[model samples]
Target: MNTATHPSESHEKLWDLIKDIKFGMLTHRHATGMMHSCPLTTQNKKLDEDSQLYFFISRKSELASALAADANVNVSYADPGKDSYVSVSGVAAIREDQAKKQALWSAPAKAWFAGGVDDPDLALLAISIDHAEYWDVKESKMVQLAKMAAAAFTGKQPRMGEHKELNLS
Candidate 1:
């Protein structure tokens, strides 16, 4: 991906793409320094703003342990139909705010906790994103296929433009 654009503009475009996708994969660095990723739901208090943080796992999953030891994290989202993707980097921490928890809570999430939102084991994971980048590919699949075929004839690799970079610090 071209990294020539201003960081602010890149961040805006990435947030736009992420807003469209709604969900993303959150990655964390384990104590062993290996990275682990899991699908997570995205949420925000404001509709116009990018998700300030993503919420998942209040208790001790491997992801939670990793976050506790090291807050560094990354999240990625892509829309196949739109051919757009975004990656966000940030620090993650457990949030115990009742108001924030109530705001993000849904009945479906209760299934993961025996006492629901009231469970002592329940914890909120908050990822404070530092920066992000995005790729936009609005062309249809047929166009991509044709491009691939043409590239094959030229003995060149086909270009699939869904790529992005984010700084998770």
Candidate 2:
């Protein structure tokens, strides 16, 4: 069976897989020289035909503070049941536009801000992705079984194929 897919096809497939999985891990570097990663709910906007960006967080968050100090950030997502994952590297900025806030707001978001649309603590974090790499197992259980069998038979290591990398800059 053919295992390789066209680069664009792989990129789209991975994006579709995780696009609806609302939560992702956002990583940022603090001034104290420590890297912090936290779970965040994200909303996406199609920046262009091929590229997409995410908006998240409130201004008062530690994660937002870290992003303000340093725009460089990384985000990761995965669906364990499907054995698919993505790691994205990007830059982030705090957006304070009222129109933008209104555009992205929803009933669920209101729970995060007590003051509603005019909440002073509300802040939009925009992530401009530079690149993303994804791993998708075509036959997850079968692959695990193959690995176990190989290790049991010859004491040899099993290797999965390379991840598909997409540059969306």
lDDT of 1 by residue, 1-169 (tens): 6553454555466556666666789888877888878888776534224336657586867778778889988888878777776767777878779887887788778788778777888888877777666777766799999998999899998777655555422
**Residues 1-169 of candidate 2: C-alpha lDDT, one tens digit per residue:** 1233455664565567677777889888987979988887776543334454556577777777777789998889988877788888888888667887787777787878888778898877777777778776766688789887988898887656446676666
**Model 1 lDDT, residue 2, Cα:** 58
Off by over 4 Å in 1: 1-16, 20-22, 45-51, 153-169
RMSD of each: 3.5, 3.6
Give the worst 10-residue stretch by lDDT in candidate 2: 1-10
TM-score of each: 0.75, 0.81
Report how far residue 158 has shifted in candidate 2, in Å: 3.6
Tell me how far the alpha carbon of residue 74 in candidate 1 is from the true structure, in angstroms, after superposition: 0.9
Q: How accurate locally is residue 73 in candidate 1, as Cα lDDT from 0 to 100?
A: 84
Report the number of the highest-lDDT candidate: 2
Best by TM-score: 2
Model 1 reaches what TM-score against the true structure?
A: 0.75
